[model samples]
Every structure is written in structure tokens, then in C-alpha cells.
Target: MDEKRRVAAVWLPHWPVERLYRADRRTRGKVQAPKAPLALAAPGQGGVRVTACNRTAAAAGVAPGQLVPDAMTLCPGLELRAADFAADRAALKRLALWCGRYTPWTAVDPAGIGEEPDGLMLDISGCDHLFGGEAALVADLQKRLHGFGLTVRVAVASTPGAAWALARYGTAPAFILLPGDEAAALEKLPVAALRLDDATVDGLMRLGLKRAGDLYGKPRAPITARFGRHVAQRLDEALGFAREPISPLRPPAPFRARGIFAEGLTRTEDIEEAVRLLAGELCRLLAHERRGARRLELTLFRADGEVTRLFAGTAAPSHDALHLARLFREKLAQAGDDFDAGFGIEAAMLAALATDTLAPAQDRFDAEGADAEALAQIIDRLGARLGHERIVRLEPRASHIPERAVVSVSAVRGATPAMRGWRAQVEEQMAAALAGSLARPIRLLARPEPVEAVAEVPEGPPRIFRWRRVTHRVTRAEGPERIAPEWWRRGERRTRDYYRVEDAEGRRFWLYRDGLYLRDTEGPRWYLHGVFE
Candidate 1:
């Protein structure tokens, strides 16, 4: 096992980020509640006293998910509104950012990963000198987050588990573990801090293993048999007896290019020229690094102490300077008509959010072969003009039906193909299908439209019917291929009998006759749905 170093674990206590967003909506009175509680009460703005009713607020009578009306009934006057998770999250991210001021290895607590999250984790082993020492560093962090309106706890230990347990469970005296004394230090802490499931904790509790020390003396075989090996493993890790791997959340790749205004820039044209200069410099940097950027960030630092950041990601990695500048040009065109340039802009930094290695080009190629560099440049220019969403390629989907055979996603050029096993299976199924097994159209509407029709059928597609108003006579018709709707999503839907027909002008059309003739209450209807290429 590897020797453990100084690791400090930080959790947000609760999901503070979510709480922040909730405050924003609730403050504007935009929140609709049976009786909304005020979120933005000024320091001295007096309102009715509303107390939380759990043991912490529950003991006061407030239960989680209780409606304002019901809660008011229980306490006569309960001040309650939704929690502001966004604002809380923003505050938490800011704290995470500030933690960068402490150590570059800082990351947001994992509480934001799923619904009821706890806190963040930081690996501060060798870099405590900048803030003096461990004790002083923890004190500084606590003061900062507290000033930002957060209740936080810091724990420093040799192992992540010990630090996490201390932060969440251990009392004040043992919050900061000393060197070579983890066993005695963790003895009194509750077993729940081991990150075990509720059932495991309950089962351990029933076995009289209340404190972490209680499980310390248990034999490995018996513990493994009775409570499973995870219990023993967690105990060993927390007690510094077994090794546990710490996976620090990776920050996005750092790729930045900056431009300083000779004189402060205030006009849109000045910003554009600055952007072009920065993009060109960024491209040179990317070329030097032998990588292409997939996302570009433009940060404008205003003289008024405000930062405005714009982000645009490519479907593929590219380092074309002219193409990069053009992408921002389209975005700038869409800015508000009354956009104000307060004070002036001092600097701009363009960063790459994603990147890929460009392949070395071959010296010679066949005449008919595509030029990779030319293709990339073309894609970059088109991506800039049409917007990222507009340029895409159809990726094959794993369905036997023609309509479900492919899907259009934001195209990534030269991307690694998705799961080979699944692709092989789909290809095998599609290989055996007959060309005329079903009449399929080149283009299918994203959604189906309903139409009224009097069909000559033992319940089949209509010959003469009105669709998007042009009544078409079915000269040639194909058999009905029924496609059932996915019932789990929208419940039971009308069944479709699809047919390919040539209209009066030899224009080919794909139509669907929905429902059966006099099926239930509604009559059979014809829908001119798709055009054949």
C-alpha cells in the first residue's frame, strides 16, 4: 500500500448551491405557494416569526415536504417557501474557487453530484505553506465561507476517510487529527461516518457495534460473514489500517490566450478586433502544443470590476484562427440592441475547454480522397455561420425500423465510434432485412399529425383524402406497416398504418392512416406525413 500524505476533506455540510438558486426565485415573489414565505427580507424588515419544526426544525413541528397550508394548520403561522439551491450552489462554487486561493488541488464537495449532497473534498498534502500551516489554513477557510453566509466544518487527517468522519461526526476537540494517533482519535466517532448504507449501519447497531471502536476488535471472518466485506473494508480504511484510493475531480483543461487593450476598448468593433487577435494567438499556441481546441471561452474584464464570459464549443477539435473569430462574430451579432459598454474593457482571455490531437497528414493521397485539413477548415467556417446546433451528421441508431435506424446528434468529426458490440448487433439485424419489406420514406416528420378521412377499408389507408389541405388521389399504394407508440412515456396512442402513394402530379408521398375504421369513437384519419426523396 502507498504511504498516506496530508489530505484535507471539505464538504459543503448541505447542498448550499441548490439553496442559493431557490432563494433567487423565492425572493422575486415569482414563487407560487399556498402561502409563500418571504425569502428576501432586509436585515431590519420585520415579519412574523416562523420557526422550523424539525428536531432541528422537525422538533418544532415542520416536516419535510409539508405544504404551506398544512404546515400553517399545524403551527397557526408557518413561514415557509422553497429552498434556493441555485444561489446556494453559486455560493458554493465561489467558495470552491476561493479554495483555489488556498491550494490548486481544490474541488467542490461531492454533495452536488446527486439530490441530497453533503460537501466537497480537497487534497492539500504538500501545499499548506502558502497559508502558513494546516490549523491556520482551516481557520482561514472557515472564516471566508462563514463571511459568505455558510456554516462549515474543516477536518484534516492523514486519510480522506478519517478527515470526512471528523468533519461530519467527530466532536470539536478531535476535529483535527494529530500525527500517528488515528486509532484513539477515531475511537468515539459514530460508525455512520464510514459512508455505509442505512441498512448496514442499522444491522451493525443491532449487533451492538454503535461506535467505530466497537468494530475494531471484531474478527475479519465474522464481520465479513455477518455484515459483508464492505463494512470491514470501510472500517479498515477509516482506521488507517487498509488503503483507500482518493479520486480528485478533474478540472476542465486549461487553454487560454489573452489580449490587452492598448487603450481601453468600449465599442463592439474594438472588441471584435481584439477577439480576432486573441484567437490567432490561441491558434498558434494550440499548434505549438500539437492539439486542437474544441471549445473557446472569451472573458471580458471590465474596468467596473465585472467579468462577462462567453462560451462556444465546437462539434470537433479545431485550431483555425479565422474560423474561431467568426464563431464569436455571430454570437456578438445576437447581443441585445441596447447592450451597454459600461466604463471600458481592460482585457480579454480566450480559453479552450476541450481539445484533440491533430493527426499527421500523409504526403500523398488518391484524387477522390477527402482532404482532412480542408474538411476541418470547412467545418469550422460552417459551424461558425450556421451555429453549432445547425451543422450535424446522422449517427446510426440500433433499431430495425427505418425511422429508428439513425439519429442526428451534434456531429463530432473523427470521434471514436460508440460501443462496438452494440453496433455489430444492430448491423447483423439490419443486414437480413428485405429492401421492399416495408415502404420507407427518406424523411420522417419528428412528430405525427392527425387528420380526418373517410377511408374505403376493412380498416386500411385512405385512397382519396385531405392532409395539409391538398387532396391527393392514391394512384399507387403500399401495404400498412404498423408502428406502435412507446406507451411507457405518453401512455397508449393511436396506431398507424403507413402507405407510400404517388399523387396526381407523380409526386411521391408517405401517408399514415391513424386509428381503425370506427375504432372506439373517432373515425379513421389520413395524414400526409413525409416526402420521399
Candidate 2:
């Protein structure tokens, strides 16, 4: 028979407390917990209440979800800290990245609001042998996590659900269930081990289904009908009858490299050197894969449990190490005082966040080709230093309205494929149309400015107009092109009678008369809409 797939679940019981304590340690430069019971509070229905508690608080009978007043009354010396959900999530994501040393498939399981425990799931099917055995891998994981001053439970089983149950609900700190042994392992555990909600678990317990074994022989339909489909689904997943795939925090990068220092490096020069090395390594990997990175991120892991991330993007996909390193350097220079190396950085990781197929370019003897490449590189550098939002290119949009005809998008990322193709098709059509028509203005105003004008009667072109506090007599006028607003979009729209007029000084302008004079009781209004070279 084929061997069953193995999954490992690593549970961090008091993640919030640990995260708080670590932050405190970093600030105070000491490894000490508060003398009094500590709790993290969140706003609840019954005023502010405790959402998480440290061991000291839990030992003093200060349970989660308890009112702050009651907890303080129970332990008068209780300390309360506001919950930092964003910080906790960031820490968990960094931990997931650190776990990449164990398996490529690692996902963070964050606790929802009001939930106690949070954990990580890793698919370690063929990785156990590398660390001696399954048990040895778990032991190593536990030891490494303990070194980081975290309390954790490690469990391995044939399925992710089974491993999760054993890790969080099992009696031991570490446990492993062999293939086909999940049923026996989970039989005596509480129904909560199936990852059911409190309401469902309560209902099951009231029905005399406290342990998983109580419903083992029962019909699936009745259980599902009573407690809902989640109960049956969780049970089946735990019993290896269903598949549960983990969505990783970040998709695995196609090209990546890491540099680890024995002792943390604090100097900026040293950090840059490490980044340069990583860039070279990543470039080699990309060359081997025949792909190039368009977006890259450099992550610095500090000794003080802080992670700093820097981003760089390219106008085009590139596999050149020096160019990539220069991009990172530009980003670092732009960061100025924002990027910190608290306590010093122990590891640096370079990841290609977005990649695309890359092939060798033709000979660059052509000056235009070289100029184009140079321009792209310049744009990439400027974008890296000045921020992508500040470096923009005008892209043609699908609109007849002058204000909506073009959009500004980041030059580095360029336009979307659909937008680019649509613009190309529109340009092709416009080229054919413009071949027989008069030239359009070089610059169009976002909003046309109202103008006072004198024109011939019977819908003729303007003879003179005053715009922007200046009067100009029309020396030449050649248009009465009528452009009507989309009647299908709205009712009672105005039709513009446009005229291309040149002044005595040879300055040309696009003037439009709004509405029809005979159709509307009020006469038409004139506006200056654009300028021509």
C-alpha cells in the first residue's frame, strides 16, 4: 500500500502573551515578566473584558472573557494591556517565514477575535527522514522554538486535521499518530478536538456526545442534521476521510537566497554586502529556472525579534544580479531613517515575489534599442528611489470624454494586459479614422473653461472669443463638428458644436458651443476646450 501523507501541526498556546512579553523584553532589554498578573483586554459587549491572560493571571483565576472588574477583584494587582492584533499577525507571519527551514509548505493559523490559541500547519510528508525521523523532527522543532522563548506543542499525524487536534487537544506536549491510527487517537478526546464552535460543542455535549467516541458509531445524517455540516466535515477530515489543503501565508518564491551571520551584523555596509551576495545567488537561481523577477523583497531578520522588509520593482523582468542589487541599494537609500537594524540583523533573505519568462535580447547595436533599455532601467531606478506612486505614466483609457481619455498608472508596474491590448486596438482604429480627418488638438483641458463669444447666426462657427480674461479675434475658423452626449446613458443631453479656430497671432484653440439654440429656449454657451500647436 502507498504510504500515507504526513502533516505536522505546531501549536503556540499563549502566543499573545509571548508576543507582548517579547516586545517588552526588546524595549527594556531584559527577560522579565510583570510581577502582577497580566492580561490583554478587548472591548466586549459587557464593557472591556479580558481577551487573553498570561500564566500568572490564569493561575490567579483570571480567565479570558471575564470582566476587568471581576479579574481585578480576584487579583487586585492585575495588569491590563490593550490587545495589538496587527502586531500579533505580523509576528505570526514572520514565524511562518522562519519555519521555511522545516518545510516549504508552511501556513500560519491565526486565532480569530476572541479565540485563545493560534498555530502553524506544515506539510512534512517526505521531510521527516532528513531530520532522522518523525519524532526527531518534532523534537528539533520544539527545541528550536524553546530557544526562542516560546511554549509550543508539536504533533504529527496522517492528516492536517488529525495533527491539529493532537497538537492542540492532546494530553502530551508532543505526540505522533501513525497512519490508520487517527480514529483510536481521537476517540477519547473532547468533541472540541474536532474544531467545532462552542455552540455546536455545547449542543453535542448536552446530547451526551462529550467525547469523539460517543458519535463514532452514530449515523452521519442525524449528526449533521442536528449539529450542522461542519461537525461531520471536521470529523471526516480528522478521520482521514476528507482532504484539507493549507493555504500558505506567502506563495513559495521561484527564486530565493539567504545569508546567515554567526554573530549579528550591525553595520550598514555589512548588511549591503549580504544583500549583494543574496542578489547574486538569486540571479543564479533565476538563470537556472530561465525566469526573471519583476518584483523583489529583501527581509532582514534582527536578533531582537524584529523583521524589516524592503521592496524593489523593475519596469521589465531582469535576471542581472548587479542591477537587482542596485535596485535594493536605491530602496535602502530612500528608506533613510525608516529602516532600522535593532539589536543587529542575524539573517537576510532575498525573495523574487513576482517573476516572468525571460529570454536573451537581440544584439543591442541599434541605438534605439540601447536607448530604450537605458530608459527602462532609469525608470526602474527612479521608481525605486521616489516610490512607485510618484513615478507614473499616462495610459490611454476607453473613454470619449477628454478628462477620462487617459489614466496615470505606476511606470514600474505598467498597464494591465487587458487595458494595454484594448488601448492598442483603439489606437489602431483611431489611426485609420484620423488619416482622413483634421488634426486634433495637442492638449485637452480636464474641464473646459467657459468662454464669451460672438458668432454668426444660424449655428455658424465663432468669429471671436474671450477666454481666461483675454480676448482673441478669430482669423480662421474651420469647423462645426457636432459631438452629442451619449443619449442612451442619460436623457436630455447637450450637443456640442465644435470649431477649430486660429487667432491673428497664429495661436489655435478648440471652442465648443453647448446645446442647440433653436431647440432650447436659452441660447447656447461657448467654452474653450483644448489648445493646438
Backbone clash count for every predicted candidate, in the order shown: 37, 0
lDDT of 2 by residue, 1-533 (tens): 11358888999877888787776676766676565688999899779998788888899999978999999999898888998877887788788777765566788864422464378888887768767899988997888677566889989998888888888889999998888888899999999888888888889999999998887879988888887788888888889888888887668775788776878888877888888899999999999888988999988877655668889898878888888898888887777787788778877789999998887778866697788667778888998888877988777765555566677787887547645576575677689557754456868888899999998775888888999899999999877777776557586477888888999999999988898977877778999989997
Candidate 2 clashing pairs, residues 3+ apart or interchain: none
As a whole number from 0 to 100, the lDDT of residue 488 in candidate 1 is 63
What TM-score does model 1 achieve against the real structure? 0.46
Candidates' C-alpha lDDT: 0.64, 0.82
TM-score of each: 0.46, 0.70
Candidate 2's TM-score reads 0.70
The CA lDDT at 124 in model 1 is 75
For candidate 1, lDDT tens digit of each residue in 1-533?
A: 22347667775443333244334443553332223222211111243333222223334465543555545666554444445445555555554544544554556555311333456667777657656788877886676555443457788888777888888776662256776677777788777877777778888899889888887777879878877888888877876779865554435346677655656689898888899999998999899888888877787766433456676766557787887888787667656464455567766778887888865556666743346556655665566656667777677764444466666766545444652345685566466344545546667777656555555755765667667676777777776778766656465466777877776878787777766655546765667677888
